[model samples]
Target: MGIALKIVLALVSVILTISILLQSSNSAGMSGSIGGGAEQLFGKRKSQGYDAILSKVSTVTAVLFIVLSLILVAIE
Candidate 1:
């Protein structure tokens, strides 16, 4: 009903979209894991380099998505 809330939600949706895209695949990449093998079964859980960033980003994005969805529903 309010313009401010609409703008905020739009901005949030954009950020959520961007962040989700910035993240690389859980697996290394296509050329490497595309075919498939035991290595493809899962990703290792360690405080490694990029993976740590990905994991953290995923968590924040997920929470934001949930919160934003709830807010939109409540507003409606």
Candidate 2:
């Protein structure tokens, strides 16, 4: 049971890491500067489509990761 929990914990950690990485950065930095006023004039679209999906998935996985961590501690 302990080993199973540990394995689940590891898998959740990996998923959390990947989901975080998959998320797009809020600030465009250089690219935004280069693009200039376009973002302002056009206005930033709300995160939709793929980004929205990733955001939701990442959120779910993050919660799962925390739960799994707690479970791992309990098992130990």
Candidate 3:
């Protein structure tokens, strides 16, 4: 892939990684399901609510990841 695409994808991948890490997991026990984990300071609900930006970020990242993989394959 082009350098620009790689750079942008890298940056996006980093953000996506961070977003996913910050968000709670789907199967993180009752704490995750109930939004009552040890890290639940204010909000940070486990469920992907309407304002769950991480979910969107994750979706975009997943698409980007797939696209990048395809691009790499095509290049090879």
Model with the higher TM-score, candidate 2 or 3: 2
Higher-TM-score candidate of 1 and 3: 3
Model 3 per-residue lDDT at 9: 73
Candidate 3's residue-wise lDDT over 1-76, tens digit each? 4776777778878987887888764556865657655456565445657437778888888798779867866776
lDDT for each residue of candidate 1 in 1-76, tens digit (9 for 90 to 100): 5566667667767776776787666555666666555655675456577756766776776777677777778878
Sort by TM-score, best first: what order?
A: 2, 3, 1
Instruction: Write the residue-wise lDDT of candidate 2 on 1-76 in tens digits.
Output: 8888788878877887888898888777988778757877888886788788888888888898889888878767
Query: Model 3 Cα displacement at 66 (Å)?
Result: 1.4
Instruction: List TM-score per model, in order.
Output: 0.53, 0.72, 0.57
Q: Pick the lDDT winner.
A: 2
Once fitted onto the true fold, the runs of candidate 1 whose alpha carbons sit more than 4 angstroms away are: 27-36, 40-47
Clashes by residue pair, model 2 = none
Candidate 2 differs from the real structure by a C-alpha RMSD in angstroms, to one decimal, of 2.9
lDDT of 3: 0.72
